[model samples]
Target chain A: MVSSQSGRRSRRWKAMHDLSPRDPHAGALPYGKLNLRRNPFGELEADDWAALALPAVDLDDVARRLREPGFRVQFVGPSGSGKTTHLLALQARLPEARYARCDSGRPLAKAAILLLDEARGFPRGGGSCALGVHEKIAGCAMTVELGAVPLDRLDLIVRSRVERFRRGDGPVPEVCLSRLGALLERHGGDLRLVFAELYEDIQDAAM
Target chain B: MPRCDLTIEFDQGKRSFAPGDAIRGLIRVRVEADADCKALKLACAWRTHGKGNVDKGLVQETVLYEGTWQAGEDRVYPFSIAVPRGPATYHGHLVNVDWYLGVRADIPWAIDPKAEEEILVSWPEGERSPDLGPAFSAPAARRPINEAHAFVVAKVLLLLGLVGGGGLLWEAYRSLGGKNVSGAVQYGIMGLSLAGVSLGVAYLLARNVLAQRTLGPVRFEVPRQYARRGEQFAASLGFNPVAPADMTKAVLKLKCKEEAVSGGGTNATTHTHPLGEWVLAEEPRRDLAPGMGVSLAGRVLIPADAAATFASSDNRVIWSVEAEIRLAGKPDWKKEVRIAVLP
Candidate 1:
């Protein structure tokens, strides 16, 4: 069982010109005051998958859980608990693998390495190393339980995202330890909701 | 796993560009370890960031290099990109449009090596801006369509009266035409009652008769249709009453929103993000006497940093004013008037 890198924390912000090409603020913010390029936690585009900052779980462990020829690896977690992100990061590493997000009452599609997200009760796809990120599924061969994210874990995740969009060696807006505690408490460890609160905070406070 | 490092640099030092301009750049690559590159691509594009779902467009793209690379090998691919017509770059509270020069090395059985550098597109100040595109008008203005509503109400009433009158004529000529006068009269009254009910329903649906009955004409003025950012624009609103309007207060807001239609066919969704808003006026009052409604005058300054209105084939940033009059015991009066804000 591979463990997440909890001891390592210091990740340096990249340095660039004062007004580097990354500050997309039309003419709003003066140059890059805080080295802010784009909001790291904003909506994801296709290319954005390469920089997901999943510091909490080791992707290699996830890959290990899906190697068997006809295995079913279910990931049971609440909404916004980094299930889809885990699938996406793995798909980035394994380009040929397919990733599908299940909608309201939609059937699962077949793939070599099927990374299914938001699955309904008890995913039914048999064989083909299906890593189902589902809800309310019972014990299985391997179940990666994503519980409420801790403050330190959240900090690492934020840093990985901010690293990709750094404007310069300047500071990056981060969810402080104190603030993270409140956010986690208020949202019941829902990372998506926490990010939304932080997103608004940065937008409101950014120059 | 196979791996490669991708880096991009523009020939020009300044990243700011205007529409129709071309960017000359070089993509430098280094393969740290052995890797089989399926394909390498360089692209110029724009994407929106902020609270809304991301919307993006690839302006230009080309395949740069492909095939295997030995360890410690360095490669350079120089190219030029013709920038697309405007949506330029915008940064607002709920929306931010950005341009980028991205390079990627797609590798099989390995993580894709990718790098992206943001760029600036400056326009709206230079050219008139991009085309408004097709299916364009979303109509930001909320000026009651006063005349159209009036016409609809009058037409509905006239139709009801005409139908009811025909029934009445039959009833009056009952003795001359039919022997069943009582039956004909009952039928006429029933027709009249049905018509009267429909008339009320029509007025309720087509227009706000309650508002008309309580207050006089509601008027708003934006002196100039076109406005430049960082400039002051004068707007005045006047209200008169037919009877004493049981109103509490009136509020006015000026907002800029980004509209982009995403997906297609039946799954198409028009995502509207209200980026920034400013309260131009909010006056509290108890009530207005008959023919004694209030008049308001104010100057609204388009923030120096505000994103000017933008429109492209599939996107638009619209500016409009919304007015809401709160009534003590009646449905509030609301209106939205569109205005043009140039970069």
Candidate 2:
């Protein structure tokens, strides 16, 4: 019975067959010798951000332009250049839409497909629908401007974070796409500073 | 086909444990349809996984089974847990600590039939690795200075920081002397020279007035508050020089770090790493007189593969010991001891 889901950590947390192939707290990890099972650029939770946010737009065209209701759009960029991973992959493909970070004090979530993140607690003639601004947010009605990070979508965000931490499935670890095109030309493409500089070189080659 | 099938068994398949040890378990259930097991929980946690932002602890819990069940049902619930004494089970390189024994079935309308099993607490083989005692309370005889009553409170804070920074630079030259000082008196003489140089460097750093004008009373000794891991303790530093100092190098360090804060509370972010540094002794130059009295001692070690003093409330594993003094041009005298390492 390998079914799972508890304490809100289910973006399909797996790779455990009675764990302990010797790592009893911090031992082996060269990304588990590149068969990968951790650190494909660490620090993830919130159930792995809608399964590793690799959205270069078209989440059904921004959920069909926020489907009516004074329809606004705006998914600009800057702080990490993916705009909250295309607004959490369009709030995980519209699970009844209602996501609001708004600089984390929330409040301003009337729904009807709201999804504002860092919206500065949204004000300024209120009304919003699918926005993840960072600057210059003036009343959008469809903007979508995620510049810089475009090297085949940073190779599809490092091939979907190394295929979501693979650890079962023959032959892994081989995507040096020219060292990720030199880390997207040395971080000017901000996929969160190129995944925080490859999570500090995979935590210094797993320490 | 309504789904629900949870399983977690560990009683003699024990998976290894220790720290009060006792983690028996068994929770099997199957439900292809008819089910109403409201609150069937059983937890025992410990979490934290790389890069930061997942510090957990839920020591023990139980509630085996709850209500009804029917339709291809089979059940069993028995558990025993009690194993804590950590921040243990680490696997650092950003962070990692784990321990699990879970089971859940708050199945109402479906979607909550969890079951987990992963244990290995260790720390019980010639046991010696759980002290994490002191973290801070700064001591150098923590607040007890009476060298002629702190030299009359450091001469009333050096005459209240040079007469309140020369009476606010002579009240900004008698109120921006004869106008033409432009807009708001040129912002009132640059806000009175930045509030008279920030009130004379915040009243001359209140009490360490350049470490009592260059090392006068500092007898810091670190009498082992806790340390072990190829331990080799002992630290010292003595001083007495109410005047005349020309030194330009003196040291003694020993640090170990890991901070991790990551998100929450107005968007928190602390992230320090450091993990190693040990000088444990150093000295050079000289020229100190005034009833001279100096001392220095060594021996610090701690590296038998160090890294054990931990504390949780967002993760930390510090261990400090610093004692510096490099004067020549004044201002450089430090002290910070905080030891607690075991493991």
Candidate 3:
């Protein structure tokens, strides 16, 4: 009887030993190794200002003009061109400014400093408004035409994000940096596309 | 400021056509002041627009008028172009293939003013054009090698080795009979060999009984390539076994998932989320003989709240039915069929 029981135990041990070669972390990221609290590239709330990589545009001049009552300024750029990022950053500096959608039915007459998004949709009216649009609108006190971020700036942005997620022990691999540069060129310096591709590469490497 | 207005109108007052159909349109231009016009051009092209990068193919182009135009010049240019017999129009979540007729007034020292109107192109009923094959091909099924034979062979060899070693040890024990010291040593050796042989046999039997069944190819039939949300559908599965075997489990499942591409450049990320799932069958098991086959049919209800199939440049929502069969002591046989869920 003892021999039979021992044999069963030995068989079970062998089965378990055969299964041990599989990766326990397959399909899941090794978050503990990277030492990150959460994915850094995920959607950011208003307070998550630290992750914002502002472009080299003159934010000071735009902010100064926006502070004045009845002063109209417009930020024009294509989608994913950091128009919203700059707008959000400017909003952080000027708390009194009101952010309003152009199509919203709400009354904007009483707004002291109106921040209108999708400026092309806004009706022509009297008020000091900061507009965000894909194309330049006529009659603005100042227009800042935003374009794609430069490759050098994009590299720094990628490096900073990686550093934020890096565990202190291991140096970031050279392959990752080179891959980021190649991706930047392929995507024409579109920062959003660059970051998304980087996040996927990191996850694949972890796998 | 110089002013120019361009308008495009389809001949039949409709903007839909099929392959080999001729697209006829009129381009009207009205100018308010004398302008150094580079050219008045009409172009027909198909382009994709959505979350993905833009891709365009110019089908044809014709110049309506070139050189200069005077003030109060108003002219109408009519055009007729035969649509290609392929490249059917498609509308998806992140990608759209659309044909357009555009008129551009190339003006010197200013932005070129242009007007464009979209037209739909489709294949005729029950027709499959060769050009649309790559764009509309069905997803390929997954196939992986079966390694059960290798596993069984290894276990059988180990069992044989244990039995042969045990027999050799027993012969040695019998050679040294009746001496107290030698007997004790021989008895211990015999007992160890017996234990090893018992363990090997038990393992071999358990593996043979639990994991050695061979499975055949799994095939599934779904109602249509696309289903509307909240629509009820039927799906069936048929499979053949290489030999008669006992099936421990069989099931079919319907699942919807969303895949999105986030980030840009070399650092793009693709993320997936399971939107909904339903089990069509469970606990289906049977014992069969060699060459025996099984077929199962079931009705599938798409949840009313399920997200409709959507595909953009870097994002997609996909729905599929999975057929899984598990045999006693063998790897599971699994197959999947993809279906699009429309809103």
Better of 1 and 3 by lDDT: 1
| Model 1 lDDT per residue over A7-116, tens place | 11111122221333343442344325556677766666655655664634577776765666556666667867876677777777666567766653445565667776
| DockQ-sorted candidate list, best first | 1, 2, 3
- Comparing only chain B with the true structure, the TM-scores of all models are 0.64, 0.40, 0.54
Docking class of 2: incorrect
Clashing pairs in 2: A25-B90, A25-B91, A26-B91, B129-B343
How much DockQ does model 1 earn?
A: 0.20
Off by over 4 Å in 3: A1-207, B1-3, B130-266, B271-293, B297-321, B326-332, B337-343
- Mind giving the per-residue lDDT tens digits that candidate 3 earns over A1-207? 756754533432222112221222211224323433223444343434324646456666777876776688888887666766666666766777776555445555545667776657444556567787888888888887878777666666655655554433444422234555677678886766765655444343332
Worst 10 residues of 1 chain A by lDDT: A1-10
**What overall lDDT goes with each candidate model?**
0.67, 0.66, 0.60
Q: How much does candidate 3 score in TM-score?
A: 0.42
Write down the TM-score of every candidate. Answer: 0.67, 0.36, 0.42
Compared with the true structure, what per-residue lDDT tens digits does model 2 show for residues A117-205? 76743444444477777675675767778788767778777778867776555444434556667777887777656776667655544
The most accurate candidate by DockQ is 1
Tens digits of lDDT, candidate 1, B1-343: 4377788787855587876788887888887998888889888888777655566665687888788888898988887878776466777655577888888888888878998877888774534544332223434443446655665776777587668766665665674377777777776676677677767655545444456567677777766766778888777777787787667888777888877653233324566777788877778776788878688777778887676775554456788887777787775676677877766
- Sort by lDDT, top down from the best: 1, 2, 3
Model 1 alpha-carbon miss at residue B85, Å: 2.2
